[model samples]
Structure formats: C-alpha cells, structure tokens
Target: MSDKRVPSMTPPNKAYPREELEEMMQKWLAANVEAEKAGDWPTYLGPMYTEDAVYSWNIGPNEDFVAEGRSEICDIALGFQMHGFEEWEYPYHDIIIDEKRGTVIGFWKQLAPYRRKDGSRFEIAGIGGSWFEYAGNYQWHWQRDFFDFGNAKDCFFQLAGAGALEPVVKKKIHQQAKGALLPGHRKLREEPSRWEKARNAMAMVKIAMTGR
Candidate 1:
C-alpha cells in the first residue's frame, strides 16, 4: 500500500439548512435514478460529489477500500470497481435522510444481470446500504457502504460454479487473490475499517443493556 493517507472526515465549515438538505437529497436521488437507467455511473454520479469527497467500503476483515477526492472516487471507485458489474442491477429499495445531520442512507440489492438456470434472478443474499454525508449543492462529501462480504463471496463462487461468471470478473478475482493491492485499497490495520461506526453502535447498545 502507498504511504498516502486517507482524508479526514472533517465536518463542513458551514451547516446546510434542513430545508435545503432535504431538497438537495431529493434531487440527488432523482439524478441517481437517471444514472442507473443510463448505465453510466462515473459520468452521472461522479459529478455529484464535492471535489474533496471521500468514498469507502469494506471488502472483508483483512482489506478495505478508500477513495479520496472526486477524481479517485470517479475513476477508481465508480469506474474500475464496477468493471464487471456494468450490467448488474442495484436497485435501491429504500432511502432515509437525516436533514439535520446532512446525511442519507440508501438500501439496495445486488442482482445479476441475467437469470439463473432455475429462471430466478441470481441475487446476493444480503442487503447492501450506503451512508452519504451531504455537502450542499446536491453533492456528497463522504460516503461509506455496508454489506455482507461473506455473502458476496458466496454469490460469486456460486456464479463460478454455475459457469456464469464473466471472464473479466474471473480475471479480477484471480488478480485480487494474488494479494496485489488494488488502487484505493489498504490493509485493514492501516486504514480505518468501514465497520467502525456499526461496531461502535453495537457496543453502545450492549453497554446500555448490561450497564457495563
């Protein structure tokens, strides 16, 4: 991994009003719908982030991804990370917005572009969600995603076993298995885990219940 540091999650210098945030989030969602329809995530979704925005997600216990700045977020995160998933469907099921905090959470599912032998869609077995920190002007300053890594792995294995995995995706999987670090990825200990917030919340709940 490069010695380059991840950007800090500093609060914006100014707070956006609740009304403005609500409107901005709605506009963002509408634009996202168009982007998904067009199948051009980098072109449509990249511009909707602040110049210095950060986007991150956890792959598993040993690795995590972090793309700092809009350029990396677009080229690497949105572009390269989606190489084999171009035709896949990731429809959002629900969205929750916190106007006061200027944040939004979107729940979605990962479905293969093609159906299985049984005539059913091949879907990952767990729900995926993203937490976005709104930056005024219908843009996001930060984003962190949550999902079941194990379920994703299992789904890919199932696809491979069924001879449904794409050639490019198989290559990607082999490359990743070789231990070469992909761009924007770091060892878990080097970069903060994306699950930190969730784990903290769980800890809080446990403490509250047990008075520990």
Candidate 2:
C-alpha cells in the first residue's frame, strides 16, 4: 500500500472527520488484534505504530518495565513472536475511541487454550484494561496500565506470552478455589496452598520444557 498522506492534510475534507478517525483507529486496532491472535506482531508494529511509541506493562519487572520508542518496544515483544503465542493465549481486545484526543482505550486479555488438541481447557479467565494513545498518523504513541486478568487461564496466557514471568501464574485457579460463589462472580475455586504448589511445579515444567 502507498505511504502517501491522506487528503485531510490539505483541505478537501477540512478537518479529520470523526468517522474517519474512528475507522483509522479501528484499523490500528485491527492490526494489533490480528497480529496478536495470529502470533505475528512485526506487521502491526511496523505498519501500525510510530517510532517513538511507548510500551508499559505497568511497572514492568522493576522500575525498568517501561520502554520508549519503537526499537525499545520491539525489544519487549520480539521474543514472544519467537517462543511464545502458539503454546499460549486467546488474546482479546476491546477498543474505545476518544475523538477529541484521538486515542483508544484497549482492554486486552490473554487466556489459556479454551480447547486443545488433547481436549483440555480451563473453565475460568481474566481480562485486562489498558489504553493506547495515538500519534495522529494511524500509529500508537503510548500504552499504559491495564488491570490483571481475573481468572487463571487469562493470567497464565499473559505469563506465557510475555516469556519473562519468573513466577508462573496458577493464582487464578487458587483464587477461584477460595473465592467467588455468587452468580455474577461465580468462578472455579483455587486455594492458596494448592495453587502455589501446582503453579511452582508448573513453572518448573515450563522452564524445563521450553528453555525460553
């Protein structure tokens, strides 16, 4: 496709139309969503984001979790494109448009295989809430905090997808075992001790299975 600028730069359309803006934002979302689901982010990162883009996994590993610029951002996700994704998630994205500032509020989630080749799946999940700031040229300028997954499978997906989770995620299952008995909040029960142990074991297995 042409890298040519749009007509709005001049005056044929005057200002950026709301519909056009939403569509453009949708395309960015589409790019991210597709890349995330298909497990290839290079396409989205290249054609869909700006050079100075920011990536924040909310406080990161240390105070060093935040990355500025496209290169830095890629450093965070490149490994995932290599060793992760396929063995992992159900990446979900919910977008909200802010026409005034030209931004999108993206709610994302990573979930365990709801179905697998061996016929195994989780009955619970969690969702994350994050936001993306646009650079006005159909690219992202910044990405900020979103909530943690509320269920086991979701966080597990995040841990696997990130490829850097030193502490594996089996908390969701434990939490479910302990909490959530109501209708709207009904979830699988996961006790503290059980989950911690199972998760630790899982962590060891994951580490041994994949040297990633």
Candidate 3:
C-alpha cells in the first residue's frame, strides 16, 4: 500500500521555544473559535496558515482529500464545506503538543444543531484529531486530520432521514458519496459498497445506543 502520511514542510532543526509555541497555539485556537462563531471564514482562521500550507484528511482506505497552498486550503478546503452547516460546531476538546517536533495535535468533535427524536442533538461522536506542523511566527505549514468517515456518513443519513438536511447540502453529500471530486481534491477510488456497509453498521450501533 502506498504511504498516506503527509510529509513535513518545515525544517527539522528549526524549533520554537515551548512557551512561544504554546502561546501561539492558544492564540490560533482563540482566533479560530471566534471566526467560526461569527461565520467569518476569511478572517482570523485563514491568517493562521502559512502561504504554502497543506490541508488534508482521509476519507477511507486509499481515498483522501488534499489541498495544497494557502489559496486552496483556505478557499476550498475550509470555505466550501461550511455552506449549509451554519449551526455545526467544531470544538477542540484536547491538545497534545510535541515541542521537539514542532507539532500539535488537536482533538475535536463535530456537532449538529438538529435534535433527534430522543431530544439529543445529532452528533458524530468519534475520534477526530488534527495534526498541525508549526511554521513559527504563529502559523502552521501543514494540517492533516483523522476521523471516522463511517460515523460521519451515518450522522448525515440520519439527518436526511429526518428531512433535516437542506436540499443543497444533501446534494453535496450525495455527490461526494458517489465519488465526485471536490476542488483541490485528488481523484477518489470508488468503494461505494464498502462505505455503505460501514455506514449501515454505524447506524445500527447508533440506534442501539440511543434507543431511537
């Protein structure tokens, strides 16, 4: 299998002081939280990334989403997905810092405002973490995320089943599920049946846990 790991863009010997790195991370997190709250994608969040930064995530085995450079990372990677998800929240619950490597991993959760029949808000509760490579001067040169796609797909299906998803949002999800490529993304290897089976299993688990 080909390596799915993202290569570091910054030099290995170049390191920032632990205190400075912590402060920078705190500032970036605060700015991102504020920008997200105000729905200001081009503001604080965009500035935290370096000019040649890379943003990426894995969809499944051998399938990935990648955005290289600031323009693609900002406009397509971060911007396009926010549509129809105005009420969605991504709150980082934990952070692990590697001072020597100049990397930080942030664990976050994706939450939707739509409530289920059991009065619980629809949420894809799974492991979601972003590994950020610090570029100094309070910016990151690389950011890659890992998350459970099966759980995410199940949440979306539940939303669609309840007629809670907007038409445009539903269409976008359908297109992606059918292997349509987004801007700055590489061609995806089709595995619709595998994804569907995973989603089905996740949905059954969710139903069992929620009793809904």
Candidate 4:
C-alpha cells in the first residue's frame, strides 16, 4: 500500500517542536473558519485536502449525506452558504495536539439553514481531524471525514452535556419543532426519522442527569 498519513490517536513521546505543530494547526482552523465566514468553501478546502480526499458527514446519525474530494465537499458546503446557513465557530477550543501521528482534533458548533428547508436554521457540533506530512514543515496530505456533529437539538444537548445549563433557555426551538406560527423562526426538523430523533433525545436525557 502506498504510504499516506491517516488520522489516528497514537500518542507521541517526544516529537517535533511545539511551535511548528501549532502553526499548521492554526492554518487548518483559520482557513476553515475564514471560508465559513466568507462563504468561500471552495478556497477553504482546496488548501487542506487532496483531490481524491475521502470524506463524509454525520458519522453517528443522519449518515445519508456523504461526499468526496474538494469539489464534491465544497458543493455540499457552498450549498448551505448559498441557502444562507449560519454557524458558531470556535477555532481554538478544546484542541488536543499529537505530534507523533500529526493530528489535531477540536470542538466546533455550526448553526445553519436546515437541509430539508430554507430560511430556518439549526445547530450541530463536530470534531475535525487533520493528518499531515512534513514538507520542511507540516503540510496536510489529506483531511478526511470532517464530520460527527448531531442535529440542532443535539448541539444544545452537547453544550448541556458539557456542564452548561440544562434549562431550555430559548423557547424558539420547541416552537419551531412544533411548527408553531412564530416570527423570525420556522420549523425545520419538525419530523425527523426514528434514529435522527433518538440521538438528540438521548443526548438531552444525559443533560438532565448532569444535575443541570
């Protein structure tokens, strides 16, 4: 098999300089966030992945949507932008750096136009893994499977799951879920499949156990 870097969790004992690793990581997250803010997804992915990059979405639930390569991935990403989907980005939060395997994983939040509907937004959280190779410094050979966030409700549960307040601070979500006539908010995930609903529901249940 042709040797290529893959995302892994193998810890490093003594590896490359810390400064060098941080630079590549900053480049990875910065470019991603820049594209997200500017809606320039094509430019966002072009630098970090190869043409034949293997990627996917919703590794846990809602696994139907999938893509490969820069073009295919950007097509899905830009589709959301063209449709006015918005997100909350945290480029520097909870980042774990491993120089041995040359990978970085961090937490992210995205709130955007729903896939099945327009003008309505939902939220999700994901972890990005970037595997790199040395070109005098680290250059990403490929970044794949940039996914694993749950649905809008799931994101809320994620925050709550992380020791945040459990009370549904915003009444807008349940309003939207029930398809109520609310201004500035619309029903997006009104009727999700059994699995889709289960993931977020169970996640929220865990939040209640956290003593809110």
Candidate 5:
C-alpha cells in the first residue's frame, strides 16, 4: 500500500469562455442523466469525446489503463471495462467546472445492482470521480478517473465470496487474471509517468521566479 508510484498528469488544455463552458456542461449533464438511466455508456458517452481523446485511470500499483483516441476510448475503456456493470448506478453527488482551465470534475458513487442478504444496498467504499478536460465543441479531449483501489477490491471480494457477483463479472475477473493484458492496460513502467515531468516543470518555474 506504500508504493510511491503516481499516475500521469494531464497537460494543460485550451480554455474556453466561462459562459460557453457552462452552457456546454449543462447540456452534457442533462444528457448524462438520461444516459445513466439507460445504462448504455458506449453509445451515449462515446460521442462525448473528441476523435483524438485520451482516457486513462490507474488499475493499481503495478498497472495502468490508457486508451488513446475515441475508438479505443469507446471500445476498451467504455465497452470492455463496463461489460458487467450494466446495472450499476453512478449517481453524481457534486460537479465542479473550472471554466478558466476548461476542466470539469464530477464526484459520484459506485452502487452495485443488487442488495445484500441483509437488505442493504451493496456499494463500493470510498469516493469515485472523473476529471475531464474539455474540447471547444462539447467534447472532452482528456479524461482521468480516481477511486480507491483497496476499497474496490474489498467490495468485489465480498460480493464474489458471497456468490452475489454478476456472472459476467465473475467471468471477467477470471479472465483478467489469466488472459493477456487488455488493449489499454500496461505495466506501470511501460509508459513514462507524467508526474516526473510535472515535478521538473515546477522546480524550473520556482527557480526562475525566486532565484532559489
């Protein structure tokens, strides 16, 4: 749990007028509500990204998921990754839009489809959210998701041990263990982690400004 590895950081994106960003976000949010209700992510969310969008999220300490371009984003990130989660609901708790930076953050909950034997809803522990960089035309060019890997593991184990997991999900867990890496997943060292670059930039800026 003490691994020092950090996920890559997205570069600064082009900014838009605050009014434009707000209007776009409002429309996008309304569409998202309907999409969530329908549970058709690939169909609904795929078009929300630019053709050359990049989407990424950390799987754990040793692996990361990165999908480049909209096709990959839709097929791998949205399609394969979401295969067994058709019935799950991710209700947004809050949304923050940084119009100056052309970014949007949405905090949500990952709720399972089924209830526990004790009649309580099964949900992943810890917070879940997505950070997105907006493109000018109502599309996102970059996206990253954050969630607690440990909590996700514990929840999955509890459901699986109790035989409450969806059949597809159980199969997927086995496949992930034994099968070859999916299209977008890579070993942690495979890609150059962007945190180092960000750190170097910060140091250079500080040195220039303060003569340190």
Candidate 6:
C-alpha cells in the first residue's frame, strides 16, 4: 500500500517535555470546550493549528476527507461538521500521549441534549477518536479522526425522521445529501464497501437493541 502519511511542514526543533506537553494539552482541551460553548471557532479553534497543518479522516477503506493548511482545516473540515452541532458536547474520555513522537490520541464522544424516546439524552453509541501531531508553540501540524459513520448516520436519521432536528440542521443535512459540498471541501463520493460496512454495523446494533 502507498504510504498515506504526510510529513509535517513545520517540524518542531525539539520534542516538547512530557510535563509541558501534558500541561499544554490540558489548556487546549479547556479552551476547546469554551470555544464550542461560545461559538468562537475562529478565535479559539483556529489558533491551535500551524499555518501549514493538514487535517484528514477516513470515511472507510477507500474514501478520505483531507484539508491542507490551517485555513482549510478550520473553514472546511471543522466548519462542515459543526454546522448545526453548536449544542453538542465533545468531551474527551481518554487521551494517550506520546512525548517521543509528539503525538496524542484522544477518544471522545458527541452528545446532544435532545431527549430520546426513553427520556435519555441522545448520544452516538460508537467509537470516536482523533490523532494529533503536535508541532511546537502549542499548535498541531496534523490531525486525523476516526469514528463509526454508521452510528452517526443512524442518530441523525432518527432525529430528522422524528422532527427533532433543528430546522437549520435539517436543511443542512438535506443540502449535503443533495451533493452540496461544504466550503473548501472537495466532492465526496462514497465507496460500496464503506456503505455496506456502515449499514451492517448499524443493523447489528438495531437488532441487539430491539432483539429483532
């Protein structure tokens, strides 16, 4: 397989000390929460990346979403996903630090405050993680995320079908389904294997939940 890795444009002169790295991460996480809450994406989130940072994620085995440079990362990759999720909480459940490699892996969940049929808040039940390559100066040179698209689709469908989605969000979803690419993002085409994998996983979860 061809190497998918992209070298960092602004490689750090030296790896950050473990304690300093940990402290920086803590501050970053806290700032992220506040940013999300305040809807201050440009001020709070944009500064976390290097000017030449690359952000990417796999849709499955074949398709990938990639955004090169901090502008694309903020305006496209991050902006597209958070379009209507202003109220959603993305709390990291775990973080693995690699001081030697200047990398960190964070496992987080997307949670919505909307009540489900069972009176519980809605949360996508699946794995969600991000890998960050930290450049010096408290900025990231690269980031990639992985998650179960099946669960995300299912949750959104449930909300939309039930008329629980905000009107703006519903409109956005419809637009996306109708082939409107997010700003600074390329055309997104799905692979058969990716669709099948997502569908199968969702089906298994539904069967387990309802014993069907």
- Which residue ranges in model 3 land beyond 4 Å of their true spot? 1-13, 188-212
Predicted candidate 6 versus true structure: per-residue lDDT over 1-212, tens digit per residue: 22344344343545678887798689789888887888656568788899998887765454467778988778877676566777888899999988877888899998886887789888888999888888878888888888898898898888877777877788776786795644444433443577898999999999999989
Per-residue alpha-carbon lDDT of candidate 4 for residues 23-54, written as tens digits (9 for 90 to 100): 86778777878876875766665646555543
Local distance difference test, per candidate? 0.81, 0.51, 0.80, 0.48, 0.81, 0.77
- For residues 118-170, what per-residue lDDT tens digits would candidate 3 score against the true structure? 89999886899898888888898889888889998899889989999977797
Worst 10 residues of 2 by lDDT: 4-13
lDDT of 5 at 194: 93
| lDDT (10s digit) by residue, model 5, range 57-82 | 88887787888889998899888888
Lowest lDDT 10-mer window, candidate 3?
A: 1-10
lDDT of 2 by residue, 1-212 (tens): 12221112111222444686687766866676676677667656565557876555432111223455677566553333233344454344566766666656766555444454466553234456656665666666666645542454354564455553333223433444584221112112333488788998999999999984
Error of 4 at 26 (Å): 1.4
Better of 4 and 5 by lDDT: 5
Q: Give per-residue lDDT, candidate 6, residue 6.
A: 37
Models, CA RMSD each: 7.5, 15.7, 6.4, 12.1, 10.1, 6.1
- Segments in model 4 whose C-alpha atoms lie over 4 Å from true places: 1-18, 59-64, 77-83, 86-91, 111-212
> Could you estimate the TM-score for every candidate?
0.81, 0.52, 0.81, 0.46, 0.80, 0.77
Give the per-residue lDDT of model 1 (tens digit) for 2-42. 65545665545455687877787677677767767777788
How far in Å is the alpha carbon of 197 misplaced in model 2? Answer: 22
